[model samples]
Target: MNIVDIIIKKKNKQELSYDELSFAFNSYLKKNIPDYQMSALLMAITINGMTMKETINLTDVFIKSGEVYKFNKKVCDKHSTGGIGDTVTFIIAPIVAALKIPMAKMSGRGLGYTGGTIDKLESIPGYKVELSKEEFYNQFNKIGLVISSQTDKLVPLDKVIYSLRDITGTTESLPLIASSIMSKKIAAGATYIVIDIKYGTGAFIKTKEEANEFSEMLNKIANHFKRKIRTIITPMDNPLSSCIGNALEVIEAMEVLKGKKSPLKEVSLEVAAHIISMAKDISVKEAKELCEEVLNKKEAYKMFEKWIITQGGDLSKIKVSDKIITLKSSVSGTISSINALNCGKLAVKLGAGRLTKESQIDYGVGIKLLKREGSKVKKGDVLAELYVNDLDIKLTDEDLKLFTIK
Candidate 1:
C-alpha cells in the first residue's frame, strides 16, 4: 500500500490495482506522502503510461480526491486541448445553456499557449468565477447553465498532477491527457460531454491521425463511464478566431452574443449550435436556428451579461479598446499561410498569455487578425492590431515572424 512500492511497480510497467491507486490518493490527501515521491511516481506513470485498468483506477482516484457534485438533471460540457485561438467555449456554453441543456462547466486557468475561460470572464469588471455547491446547484436549477471556476476543493489532486505534467514534458501522451480531462469532467458530474478535438498547426495535436486516436480513446473512456461523449475534429491550422487573447476574445464573443457578422462571430455561433444539437439530439439546423434566435433576438447577449454578473465580472464600462497597435503587412502578396504557434508565441510576448503557469496576463494585450488564409493584402494594410494594457512591452522582429506578407 506504500507509494514507493506502487511507484516501483508502475515504473516497471506493472499494473497497479484499483485499491492500490485509491490508497495512494487517499494517503496523498492525508499528507502522508511527500510531493517528491509522488512526483517520482507521476513521472514513472508518464514514461510507462497507464494501462486501461490503471487509467480507470487513476480516473477513480482523482474523481474521489475532492467533492463531486451530482445533479438529478442531465448536465454536459465541452473541452478542448489548448489551441492557438480557440474561443469556442466562451460562445458555446451560453447557447447550449439557453436551450435548457444543463451546461455545468468547470474551467481552469490558461496554460502554456492557450487562454483560459476564467481569465476571459475576469476581464469583465465584476465577474465571479467561484461558486459554492449550493450556489452552483441553485443556478443550474434556474438557468440550466452554470459556468464556474474549478473550486479549490474539487479534484485538487488532478490540478496538482496536471501542472506537474505540463512542466515535466508529459503533456503529449494521449492516455494522460484524456484521463486528466475526463477526471475533472467526471468529478464535476457531467452526464454527457462533448469533446472538440482539433489538430493542425495551431493545436496541441498537430496531425489528424493523432487527433483521431485521442478522440477515439476519449470516446471509449466516456462509454466506459456510461456517459454519452461526442467528438468533432476541426482544423486549427489558422487561429480559430480573429481574436486570440482574453479581453479581445471576450470582445469577439460579445459580437457573437450581439449577432455581429464576422468569421470569429460565425464560427463561435457554429460551434455553439453543434454542442447544443449534440447534447439535445436535435438536428444541427434546428439547433443553429434556436441559437441564432438567442443571438439575433439579443437573448444570447443578455445571457452573457448575466453570466458575467453571475461570475462576479463587471459588465458596465467594459469596452475593448479598438485604438490598437497595428502590426502591418511588410509587402503585398498572398498570405499563403499563418503559423498558429508563432502567433500564440507573439500573443504571450504581447502579454496575452503566460509561459509559466504562474505568470500573469494582460486581458487587453492580444491581436485581432483582419486577414485569414487565402487572402490577398496590400502593403501597409493593418493585418493585426495589438491591444495592450501596458504601453511598455516592445514588439520586436521575433514577435512579427509568422506575420510575413510575402
Candidate 2:
C-alpha cells in the first residue's frame, strides 16, 4: 500500500504486483508520494529493469491517469519515436485522410535533435495547435484528419515522469521509454496505430537491433491494450528529410504533398502506404499506388490545405529566414555520409531547435541539404545552407566534419 514498500521491492529486484505498481503510480499522481521516492523507484527500475507484466501494469496506470478520447468514427493514428527531420506525419495523415480514413493525432514539441510534429505544423502562420475537443472531432468528421497538441488531461503522468527521468539520468530505460510513448497512443483511443521507429546517430535507438527490440516491446505493450500496431524501423544516420528546421520542414512537406520528387517524398510515401494498407486492408502495392495517386493528383495537397485552413494555419506567410549561409564543398568527390546527430546538434545551436521544453525555437532558422548521399560534388559546390536569426552563427570543425566526401 505504501510507496516505500514498492521501491524497496523493486530495489531488491523483486517483481512488484499489479496493485503495487498501481499504488505507486496513482500515489505519485495524487502527490501522496514525494518525487524523491519516485526517483528512487525509477532508479531501481533502471538498474533492475521490469518484467513485461510490470511494464504493462505501469503503462495501464499511466493511461488511467488521464482522459481517453473516443471518436464517433473508426480511429487511426500514426506516431514516430522521433528522428532528425521527421515530418512523415504531415504526409501520412493527409494521405490516409484523403482515403476517407479517420486520422486523429496528438503530437509534441522538439526537445533536442528530433523534430516535433506540432512544432513543424505551428511554423505555418496562424495555425491553431490547441483545439478544443469539439473542434478536433469536427475537423476529423469533416476532413477525416486532425492533428493537435497533446492535452494535459491525457496521460499527464507521462509528462511528470519524463521530466523526472530527464534530470535523473534514467531516460534510457527501454521499459520506461516504451511505456511513456505507448501509454499516450493507447490513451488516444486509436484502434489502428502505425509507428515509425528510427535508429541511428540521430535517433533515440542507436542501432537497428535496439530498434527492433523496442518495436517488439512496443507491440507487446500495445497488444496489452488490444490495439493493433504496426512499426517500421528506419535509418537516421542522416536527416530523414531534406530540411532540418521548423518552417523549412513545413516547406519540404508541402513539396511532398505537391508531388515533388525528393527523399522526403520517397520515405513519406512508404510510411503512408503502410498506413493506407492497414486502414483499408489492402495490399502494400495497392496502398502505395493509391498514396502516390493522391499525391500526384494533388488530392492530399488539397486535404492538407483544407486541414491548415480549418485549423487557422496560413500557407502564404510561411517563410524561412533571409539570413542564409551556404557551405560549399571544400573538395570534390562523392558524399559518402552525413552525420544526422551532428547536424541536429548544430541546428539546436543555431536556434532552430530547443535544448529543453522551456527553450524557445526560431521557426525561421534551420539547415537545408542541397546534396545527399552518393552525390558527387565539385570543389566550391554548395553542399548545405544554414538559416539563422543571428548572423554570428559559428560552425565548429566537428560540425564541418559531419559531411564526409570520398
Candidate 3:
C-alpha cells in the first residue's frame, strides 16, 4: 500500500494494479510521496515500459484525480502532439462546428518550440482562456463550440506528473505519453477524438515507426474506453503553416478559413474531415466535401467570428509588431526545405514562444514565411519577415539558415 513498494514493483517491470497506481498518484498529489521517488518510478516505467493494462490503469488514475466534465450534447475534440507552426486547431474547430458538430476543446500553453492553441487564442485581446464549469457548459450549449485552457480541477494529476516527466527525461516514454494525452482528452469528455501524431526533425516522434507504434498504443486505449478515435500521422520537417507566432498564426488561420489555399488549409481540412466523419457517422470523403463546401461558402469563417466574439476575443485587437526584418535569399534557386525546428527556435528568440512556463509571450512578435518550400526565388528576394517589438531582437546569419535554398 506504501509508495515505496509500488515504486519497487514498477522498477522490476511488474504490472501495477489500479489501486496501486491510484494510491501512488493520489499520495503524490497529497504531498505524501516526494518527487524524487516519483521520478525514480517514472524512469523505471520509461525504461521498463508498461503493459496496456498498466497504461490504462495509470490513465484511469489520472482521470480519477479530478473531475470529469460532461456535456448535454455529444462533443468532439482533436489533439496534435506538439509541432512547429501547427495551427490546425484554430481552423479545425470552427470548420467542424460550422457543420453543426459540437467541439469542446481544452488546450495547453506553449512550453518549448511547439505552439499551443490556448496561447494562440489568448493573443487576441480579452480572449478568456480559463472558464468555470458553468461557463464552459453554457458556452457549449450556446454556440456548440468551446475552446479553453485546462482548469486545475480537470486532470490535475496529469499536470503534476507531466511537469516531473518533462524534467526527468521520461517525456518520450510511449506508455506515459499515451496515458497523459488520453487522460486529458478522456477527462474532457469528448465522445469522439482525433489525434494528429507528427514525426520528423521538428516533432517528438523522430520516425514513422515510432509514430506508428504510438498510434497503435493510442488506438488500444481508445478502444478500451469505447471512445471513437482517429489518429493522423503527419510529417513535420517543414512548418505546417507559413506563420510561426501567436497573433501571426491566428491571422494565417483566418486566411485559411476565408478560403486561402495553403498547407495549413489542407492539413486542417483533413483533420476536421476525420472528426466530422466520426461524429456524424459519415465517410471521410463525404466529410471532406462538406468541409470544402463550408470553407468555400465562408461558413467556417462566419463560425470563427462568432466563436471568437462569444469567447470575448477581439480580432481587431490582435496586432503583430510593426518592427519587421525581411530575410532575403542570397542565391537564385528554389527552396529545398525550411527547417521546422530552426524556425521554431528563431521564433522563440523573437518572443513568439516561452523559454519557461513563466516566460512572458510577446503576442505581437513572430515570423512570417513569404515563400515556402519548393518556391523559386531570385537573389535578394524576400524569403521571410521577422516581426519584433524589442529593438534588440535581431536576426543573425544562422537564423537565415532555417531556409535551405539551392
lDDT of all predictions? 0.77, 0.84, 0.89
**Structural similarity to truth (TM-score) of each candidate:** 0.89, 0.92, 0.92
Cα lDDT tens digits, model 2, 60-145, are 88898998888766788888888888888888778888888888888877745677788888899999998776787788888778
- lDDT per residue, candidate 1, 1-406, as tens digits? 6788998998899988989888776777677887677778778876787777677667778877888989997788888777877777877777777666778888876766777777777777777678888888887887777777777678887777666565566666677778778888888998878787878878778899989888888877888888888787877888877888888788777776777676656666666777777777889789889988877777776776676666667766566655477778878998888888888888888787766657677777787888887889998887887777666667778777766455
Measured with C-alpha atoms, the lDDT of residue 183 in candidate 3 is 90
- Model 3, span 130-184: residue lDDT tens: 9987898889999999999878899888878876765567767889889988998
Total clashes for model 3? 0
Ranking by lDDT: 3, 2, 1
Error of 2 at 76 (Å): 0.9
Off-target runs (Cα >4 Å) in candidate 2 are: 1-14, 23-48, 163-171
Name the runs in model 3 displaced over 4 angstroms.
1-20, 33-48, 163-170, 394-400
Per-residue lDDT value at 331 in model 3: 92
Residue 58: error of model 2 in Å? 1.6
